[model samples]
Structure formats: structure tokens, C-alpha cells
Target: MLDLVSRPAPWHQPIWQQLTAQQDFAHAYLFSGQPGGGKRRFASAFAAFLMCDAPEHGFACDQCRSCHLRLAGSHPDLLLLEPEEEGKAIRVDAVRQLVDFISQTAQQGGRKVVVLQPAEAMNVNAANALLKSLEEPSAQTYLLLISDQPSRLLPTVRSRCRVQPLGLPAGTEALAWLTEQGGERSREECALLLQMAGGAPLLALTLAQQDALAQREKVVEGIKALLKGQVAPSRLAEQWNAVPIELLLDWFCAWTLDLLKLQQGAVEHATSADMEKVLGYMAQKLEVQRLLAWQDWLLEHRRLFASKANLNRVLFLEKALVQWKNLLQRR
Candidate 1:
């Protein structure tokens, strides 16, 4: 549903102007930034603009044939490459498909745009496959690779492309975006998502709509169960074992850290009232140093889980809680 109009104000205006001024673009351009900050929308709109037969000042004419096709989600040149379903990484096979597509003549013999998002998600084989395409790109084909973590991409891939990095909009700008979304302007929710999402507006919006009301209620219930000290860590593990470790860890980090902040008389920002309950309980048992140590442990575990490996997440989380719980018991 993202388009030019719906894009964040800063991105919608500036990038369009720059691309408009370009006489001819390099074959490979990289768009890297915090997730949800409008990189994908900019890519799509740029693609739409390039294909528009009658563009308006570097903007797409929604009524044009190409624009219509794009609006219908059927543009031939508007290809999006991504990770394969059920697989954690983008495959070499998918890169091959993109290479083939970009090498061919455009459906209408105009410019073609290929967008590969979260390009950092590509594995070694996939990155290598893409390198060949970039090494000798088609004359009229343009590649836009979007990435949240540019460091994850191969240095070779990074070198071939002109990287454009997006940044967080100022508070005033972000608040304007939230107002457009028709929210009551809760800076707590806004700041939490912004911090976690790494400054991506779209990501913030998506997380904001995560049926958080329900998920938050569940998280509160889970914390309450754990606080009772009667609930076994194994039982708690079982409840959340199947969920992605990153999800559980991230929620835990935000939920607890905010409370520690509030207890210190810092401005109570970002933590929902539901999060306060767990915070209060934790503050009683955990000194600042121990709480921070536990947070670091979870963060390290999160990184390991994201890599090319399998782990017993349940056991890991259980072990982590065991230490924290014992601390509570001792005190």
C-alpha cells in the first residue's frame, strides 16, 4: 500500500529530485538504511517513475500503462528479488533469475528496474551470483539493492554499487508521519519502535500495527506467570519455544529496560503501562548491573541465533532465566 503520497515527507521529496536530475544512472545502486524508513517505497516509486510513459517531474503518472501495471502489481520491469519462503537466506537460484531478467530486453524496450530488498539477507552463494550480474550489467537495466545492515553484504557487492543511506527523520517529522497515520501521538510507542527498528518509518508503522494490544497482553500474562515463581522456567520455555528467539529477546529487552529507566526517574517514554508491571517486579530483584549484564547476555544470544547455525533456543532461554530467577530467589 506504500506509494509516493504515503511515503515519509523527507524521502518523498529529496530522492525524487536527485533521480530526476540524473541524465543516466549507474547499473547498480544500493539503498541502505534502517528498516521501514521508506527505502522500499522509494525503490518502488522510482521504478514506477522510470517506467512511466508520462511522468510528472520524476514522479509516476498513475494513469500511464506502466504505472497502471505497477498499481495492479503486474509490472514486468518492476521485479522484486527476495529470500525464498521457508529459507532464511536469499538463494543463488533467485539471483540467477534476476540476472536473466535484467539481461533481457525490457517488455516495452524501455528502462528496467530490479529491486532486491534486505540485500544483506543474501548468503555467500547468492551474493556471488549477484556479483556476476553487477560485474557486467545490461545497458538499460538498473539494480537497486535495499539493505538494513550494509555490513552484512559482501565487500565486493558494496564496491560495485553507489550506496544511498537513509536516516531517521527528526522528531517533528516523525510525529507528522504518525499524525498522518491518525494516532494520538504516543511518543512512547513511537520511540520504542524507532529504536528497535533502527529508524525505519515503515518498520515502525508495521510494528505499531502488530496486534500489539493482543501480543502485549500475552507478554504481560507471561511475565506475571514467571513472577509467581511457581511457574517452571521449562514451562515458560515451552510456551515461547517455537517463537523466534529474536522476537522473544527483543520484546524482553524493551519491556524490561524501559522499567529500569522509569525507576531511575528518567522520563517514562516508550514503555506501555503493561510493560511497567514486569519492570516493577524486576527492579525489586535486580540491581542495575545485574539487569544490564542479563540484557547483554540476551543480545549476544540473539546474534548467535541469527547466524548460520541451529540451537536449542528453549534451553538457552531457560538457562538465561534460571540465572535471573535464582538472583530473585536469593534476594
Candidate 2:
């Protein structure tokens, strides 16, 4: 469960002040960002602020009745909508329930708030069902939508709300926060985790908890072995059975982008140290058209992964490795 009463992330304090000082609030707000960039935490904090009967210094006064109810997870006016299962679509029935919830008067006689996270999980019917609520918001009611991929949302849905993008914080700021949260982790380890998380501090901490560095090392070594023809693609895929597909795809996507930059001579070196030589070698060997084709294929599969399509893990990994190794083949 999210820490609903906690303060916003350090990078978001400025926006918190700007929002809480507002004399009027928008009926609907869309908070969008990459996963682990504190969009959820910001939304939760903002919701707490919005519902509080007493706000102090641009934050929720935790002593109020509303704050107490919210902290106890029994706030009658607050509704949270999320997929019943992770990575599943938000069904239309859930949106219909939301519509019904919105029609009722506030039991607490205060403003009503709805928080729907990963808003892109709403299927077409669910999204359409939500449009009615967005179009006809009730008095003193606010709907907050959190999305990691705002582009997947319907244009009609996006246009109805104020869009707030939560991007990665400054490198030094993120590194500092991550270091504090990382406990005994060395500064260098924290920095590496931050890099792995694309500079998102919360995500950097999560990756540390998952022991992602060891998994990453295994993947890198496997890729090197594949390129050297020391291991077969099928065997490598089998060895990677325990690795999360999403993480693997993200790393490959980043490396693919790096390859494009190197081939274009935009950068003299690769951005990540682990694969610097491999990326450099591929940049020299790969034709632009071939690399672009690989990118297209990889992106299409990434979409599949996001959509949670039923995929054969071993076959998918084997095919991906084969295609990746083929990038070095002579045309």
C-alpha cells in the first residue's frame, strides 16, 4: 500500500507549494511519468492535501478528522481504482462502479477524491465509461489519474484533465536522495543503480532491493558470449528464465538507442560502461537500415510486453537473441 500521508518527494516540493496555494482546483488531474518517478506518491500527497480540513505549510495536517480517516484506510469519500491483478486491463465494470461512486453525496460532507493509478490500464470500454465522469464532474470533487504511459490513454480522456508531467530530477539531487535511502550502499553503487533506473531515485532504490545488479551482470555476460559465438541463443534464453522480461527489454532498448547514437557519430563513446565495447563494435559493423529494422522489431515486442500478451518466454528470448546476433552478420 502507498504511504498516503507522507510528504512529496524532494524534487516535487516546489510543485506541492504551487498546488496547495491554489484558490481553486481542477476537477480532474493527470499525473504522468516513467515508472518509479514519484508520480504515485505525488498524487497521494496531493489527494491528502486536497481532502484535509486543515492544511499547514502546503501539506496535510495529519491531526484532522479527514486525515485520521484517510490514514486508517477508511475514508468514505476517497475511492481508489486499480486493476484487480497487476498488468491486467481495468475492466468496464470497474469504471461503472466509479461512476456510481461519483453519483453519491460525500459521506464525510467534504470534497470527494478518486485516485486511479496506471490509468493507461483502462481498456477502451473502461476509458469510454470514464469519459462521462470526466465530462460531468460533481461539485467539490477531484479525480486524479496516474499513468506511466500517458500516450496510451485516449485523446478525449487526456484532453479533459490538467496534465502534470513528473520527469527525472537533477542528477545530483537524485543521487543524494538515493544515497540516503540506500543505507549501507556505497555512493558508487547508488550511482550505478540511479543510472540503471534512468535517474529516477525511487526506481533506483527499488532496483537495489531487487538485486538487479547481479541480474544485469548475467545478461551482459550472456550478450558478450552470444556475440562471440561461445553460447547458443536457445541456451542463453534458458539461462535467463529467472530474469524479468520487462527489465531485459528496457536494457536492450537503451542499448539500441545507444547504438544509433554511436553509428551517427553523435557520441564518441557509449553511455553505459558495461556494454561500451560491444555497442562500439556493433555500431561499426551494423548498417543504418538494419539497425533501424531491429529497433522497429524490438519496440513492437516491447508494446506486447506492456500489454501483457501471453508469450512463450523461451521462444521470445531465443528469437530476440537470434535477431540481435544477426545484426553483426554481413548483408
**Estimated TM-score per prediction?**
0.79, 0.92
Q: Please, what are the lDDT tens digits per residue for candidate 2 over residues 259-329?
A: 99999999999987789999999999988899999999999999998878888889999999999999999
Worst 10 residues of 1 by lDDT: 1-10
In candidate 2, how many Å is residue 221 off? Answer: 1.6
lDDT of 2 at 239: 99
lDDT of 1 by residue, 1-331 (tens): 2253322246457766876678888888887776667777777667777778888756777887877777887878778887765337888889999888977888876888888877988989999999988998888888888887999899999999988776767766775575478565467666655555555667767767764434545655776777777688888788765455665777776755675675576754535465565566666566676667777887777778767458787788789667656545543
In candidate 2, what residue range of length 10 has the lowest lDDT sum?
1-10
lDDT against the true structure, per candidate, is 0.72, 0.91
Candidate 1: where is the Cα deviation over 4 Å? Answer: 1-12, 183-199, 228-245, 255-293, 307-320, 327-331
Which candidate should be chosen as best, given TM-score against the real structure?
2
